[model samples]
Target: MKKIIMAILLLPIFLNFSGCTKKTNEIPKTSTKIEKSAIEDKKSKVNIILFYPSKEGSSLSASSRLVSFNNSLERTILEEFLKGTDTKDTLYIIPKGTKLLSVSRKEDTIILDLSKEFNDISTENEAVLNNTIYSIVNSLTEIPGIKNVIIRVEGKVPKINNISFENPFKRNRSIFNRDKTSKPNDILKKQMEFESQGRWLDAYLLYSDDENNTYRKYFDDYVKENEEAFAQGFISKNFTVGSYTVDNTGTHALVKVKFNDTNRELNIGMIKIEESWMVDWIPPQ
Candidate 1:
């Protein structure tokens, strides 16, 4: 009876031991599954990152990010005006979408690596290149360290950002002011002033005077009364030569005239000067 009881207890103990061993083996398999899930989650996180990728991406591009600095004086005109986004350590530069690349900086000048896209530049496309370069230079200057930037394509230096292969458009003109830009003719004005002052030349030179011109008749009478004294002074004084400029076209110049010390302003019609700009008073019909 004692031997039978002892065998039954030992049998129960052995069965429990086998069960525990099976569970232990399963734990390792479960742990492996958990490890695989964690690895997959990490990969997904990497794909979600939103920065401009590395140089080995679909097309290599190196663009600057506009950043802000504490030194306010270094901020360029463009930087000051276009200040909406965060630029705290970001340097703004023109964006690029090309596969080719190159960068060379010497002193204050920086040359960019260019490709075929820069071949034939258009007016609209110029903005991109200009603004891009401008942005880079502007940003760089803000560091209080660098100067301006010069861009070159295919190892050749170019004046403009892009040039057209065909005959290009004419250069646009600069704006001019009407009031301050032009100077008044002092000599012609003096002649007109003398006439208004009642001094006139000889009637012989005046040929015929019409009844219509009140000022003309007055001057003729003044000439007749003053005689040689008026003739000498008036002829010499009335020798007013108004000037007109036709510029490069050589079309005509509008000459403004004033006689003697008179404040009256007179405008002579433009004259046609062949192959050059000429201005003269339009002779009375």
Candidate 2:
């Protein structure tokens, strides 16, 4: 009878050990699922458009920035646009004390009611007036369902200089920056544009073969090793193209860039390869 009781007590211990062993083997599978979920979450991102004054202060340019997916995407985009660019390379055209009163959607249009402070912008500078209007308009129109933007100040349609706010404002791509007969300058502009938006691969592809340039030979490896620094370096440096000189052959060019972060200027070298102008070397940070 004692042996029978002993067997009954040991049975529970044996079953418990087996169950623990099974779970131990399953742990790796559970961890893998969690890792995959994290990767999927990272892959899911949304793009938001932001308008900022050009580095050369010519006009406003639109930059695409990524953010985590959210239900209130419009509201989130508006908030981020209002906050302005972190790098300060571009000017925040919005007036101070401005608030987003309300956002209403109708069909394919979005109506934004802004606070009275928005009307306080000076109309003397027509460029400023135009930029201010479309900065808000252009930024909001980037949202999927918003084809047009209607703006109101304190619930009343206000006039910004000569332009009327009564009608819905469509996107004005012409107002954005454009190339002006300087193809090499345009290439440099694109390089900075991609870098600003954290599109490293797009930016890296602009480089050309230079045996002396480490960035060309080990470009991918260098970016992988210094991913964080590479991103920070590009985003933080607001480069203003100062002066550009092209060789008589049109194959070699030296472009000077002024940085907001440093007093020193950066001289970037470019070479025309075949029919395209490519960056010869990565600019020193």
Candidate 3:
């Protein structure tokens, strides 16, 4: 009778110890599952488009990148914009040492408060100032549901030259290096045709508004100089159009053209302007 009672007591103790051991092992597994779920959330990503100035500072170039998605997505984008791009032949238009102070959204507009360095760009030159503002505006407006951007320096709107930041700035499509509607080859062919027909004004219109081009700056002088070439048929019969290759940025291209009745190939530089490609530089015949 004494042996049977001891055996029953020991059986209960063994069962209780086994139950405690199982609960301890299960605790770590449950914790591991929760940790895995949190890690998955952190790994989530979303695609975003960023705009930067072209190396020439004549137009804006669009770059697409994947960024982590979270509650502070807008802020994250602005931070990325400030960090600039690694793309060659592109420029980070934002003033160096500039910092994003804060960001908030109201309806369709996002207000960006930036450090004082943001206002230190060259305001005297209209193109430079316009490019600087649009680089930020165009970048943020790429976000869905965000139609405009309001820029502020030190919590207050700034007036730089003719541009006033008191109101929300909308995205300007004219500032982009290229749009979806045009091809570089087609544009170059059209320009050459216009030149062959002696349509000087038409050819001039095809040229980009590059601040550095003397022909664009002195339109009358360009036409006067080209008159003799047009009369001699030199401009019309110089080269035959050939194959072309565009760069990865899509803003620049190398077009090949052959000298008339010769095996000589001349490579011309083409730059995208708005929706059309414009001859950046044409070599002397």
Candidate 4:
């Protein structure tokens, strides 16, 4: 009878130990569903994004084709301004001439590294250059969050045909789309019709002042000076240019651009300056 009593007491202790062990071992399971949920939560926070802007001028068609969304127009504007060419027919190959070498995105700008063949492929013909310009800008500008595009070739900076590539324009870059506030300078604007058509060398001379803009003295002398009138007339914030062709002599162009606030359109023309690349627009302050 005493042995039976001892056995009953040991049984209660064993049951208590077993219950404690089961409680200590239990844990919540984290499976694929939980992990996926965490990842999705992280992705939801990254909605705002900026795109690349162009230093090379491209064509309107090129800009339009850069992206599908409407907000991407900023990116296209920068690109077309820099590239100064149209790239519509190159659908047989890649959309933008040679394939892009590399594309890096910064806060408000995009740095694009071009393939080696960029210089050799389109170097000879002005039409090719225009096509190239239009294609690159039109394509990239359609993406939102991109404001600037700095183009390089084979990991090196390519020189502008006539002018320096060093300057980036805030005035030009700041405004996009057609501005309702803009007007026209009927006489000067009409004189500059060809500049928008991609006459690069002629466009450059129209703006370039000899040695520190000594040419500005002639701004007072409006009759003989075509470029000064064009510069003086630029008063609006917005700008837009349509598609066109270029005649290539590998020479830099003198550009006379008149912004007609009354007409709300830019009048562009070109005269031969020298052999060099023509940058489309300088940023306004």
Candidate 5:
């Protein structure tokens, strides 16, 4: 009878210990839900520019693309840009075989290391060439805080057929749609046409005083020295006007031109002296 009484007293104490152990081992359901909610909130949506050929096939036009934010935002945009678009009407700017090897960022600038297939772009189509470059530039610059882009191929700055890709490019919104009444555009078009038709003197007449004197002396020396390449360097098979930016004061401007024989843009600087807009002495500024 005494042993039975001791066993009954120990049973309540054993039940209390088992209940405490179960409570301590359980996880809070609220904490797990909070962690999962934080992970879902990290993802966001951003708008990026995608360039495609216009309806007439003459130039490239910008279109809006919605993308999910990722750690490598610029790379994600480029990969999507390379993939073209879902709609059948849009087109890819970079060549089909081209590959983006790597991308790195430093403050306001993004550096792109691309493969050799990028070098083989057909310059005969000037619009395609300019679009290929700006499609990358304008698209990447859309990301907040990124202002410029530098491109390299095969670990070296590209220099091909009188074109140099060594300069860093700024975002050009002017290329989206050209302004027909732009005086800078008219002057550049006339000058380029004159040169393409072998009218060197007519083309030189459109230059500012400094450019005229410099080119005159250059050609005179070239003629006397029997150096043909120096003079021939000014000539191009054809050119298409891409973009132009005029200062607020309306006296200075920068015009972008792409040549049929070269893959890079030629930025021509212009100044409005008195009444006429003339190509300045310094071509690229």
Candidate 6:
């Protein structure tokens, strides 16, 4: 009888140990599943660049965000663009109620279908129309393996004035205002060379005569003042152009130059005059 009672007591202890082992193993399995799920969620996200119209409607500005990677990435990008940027200086270029209907991809191009509201932008000015079209094109083309974009409105190609959506549109970098046509670095270099050589007349002629220019007076007075300043060592002869950036309008630029001898840096203002870049103002040291 005593042996039977000892056997029953050992069986209860064994059962309790077995239950504890099972619970310990279950905890790691559950934790492992949770970690794997978090990793997959993290891997699904990617960063994408988006373009929008500046507040002035004169140029395109770029913004970036993270999105889920999937077959519908193109549609997702378009949807994010329609939602617009949160930046106060940029505006959504698409019509308010426009919707992305579908997204398909060919060899190197992404084809987009949009709602009828996209076609309702006929009353917008040319700049607005251009911004709307290129904002979509540029944003999509930024994706890898995408070279062009074709936009269709309600299953039909759209044509507003001379602009047409029947053909694939490539990214237009000129709309970013950083293209070769708007760069003012070369003009600033030439003006610096002229000033260094004491050719005041040539340098003065590089100034814009636009009515908005408040820096220049008469041609004779400009030349005389520059000559006197050079004789008095007011202008440095040894300088190097560093870097420059053009304004959003593409009509104005600020160029940074370093005086090699004196180790001083100054910003020179430039303006576009007719077809040429001209020096509008120089900061007084």
Residues 1-285 of candidate 1 have per-residue lDDT tens digits of 111212332457657678688676564544687787885664332100001112222211122332232222222223332332232422323223322245544654444545545444334444344443444343333222234444455655544545332231221111100122232333234333444354333121111122222223222223334443333342223324456544465443445544333443345433332222122223421
Q: CA lDDT of each candidate?
A: 0.34, 0.63, 0.66, 0.35, 0.62, 0.68
Name the regions of candidate 3 deviating beyond 4 angstroms: 1-42, 123-125, 179-285
Tell me the lDDT of model 2 at 135: 77
Against the hidden true structure, what lDDT does model 3 obtain?
A: 0.66
**Can you write out model 2's per-residue Cα lDDT over 136-159, one digit (the tens) per residue?**
776666454456888888899987
Instruction: Please state the error at residue 156 of candidate 6 in Å.
Output: 0.5
**Each model's TM-score?**
0.22, 0.48, 0.49, 0.29, 0.46, 0.51
- After superposition, candidate 1 runs with Cα above 4 Å error: 1-100, 125-132, 159-285
Q: After superposition, how far is residue 274 of candidate 3 from its true place, in Å?
A: 10
- The segments of candidate 6 whose C-alpha lies over 4 angstroms from its true place after superposition are 1-32, 122-124, 179-285
lDDT of 2 at 146: 57
lDDT of 6 by residue, 1-285 (tens): 111212332457557678688666564544677788887887676555578888777888777666676566677788778887887787765668988888999977898899998776763557866886798888786554577798889899886678877788987766764423535778778776787687654565465545434444543345445655567565665678768888899888888877666576667788776656877754422
Weakest ten-residue segment in model 4 by summed lDDT: 46-55
Q: What's the TM for model 6?
A: 0.51
Clash pairs of candidate 6? none
Superposed Cα deviation of residue 200, candidate 1 (Å): 77
Q: Relative to the unseen true structure, what is the C-alpha lDDT of residue 228 in candidate 4, on a scale of 0 to 100?
A: 29
RMSD of 3: 25.8
lDDT of 3 by residue, 100-193 (tens): 8889999778998999987876634467667867988877765545677889999987867788887888877787644346576667777777
Using TM-score as the measure, the top candidate is 6
Q: Higher TM-score: candidate 3 or 6? A: 6
Checking candidate 3 for backbone clashes, the offending pairs are none
Candidate 4 residue lDDT tens string, 88-148: 3232112345445556667656667766655554343443454444344333432433445
True-structure RMSD, every candidate: 41.8, 18.6, 25.8, 27.1, 28.3, 25.4
lDDT score of residue 162 within candidate 6: 83
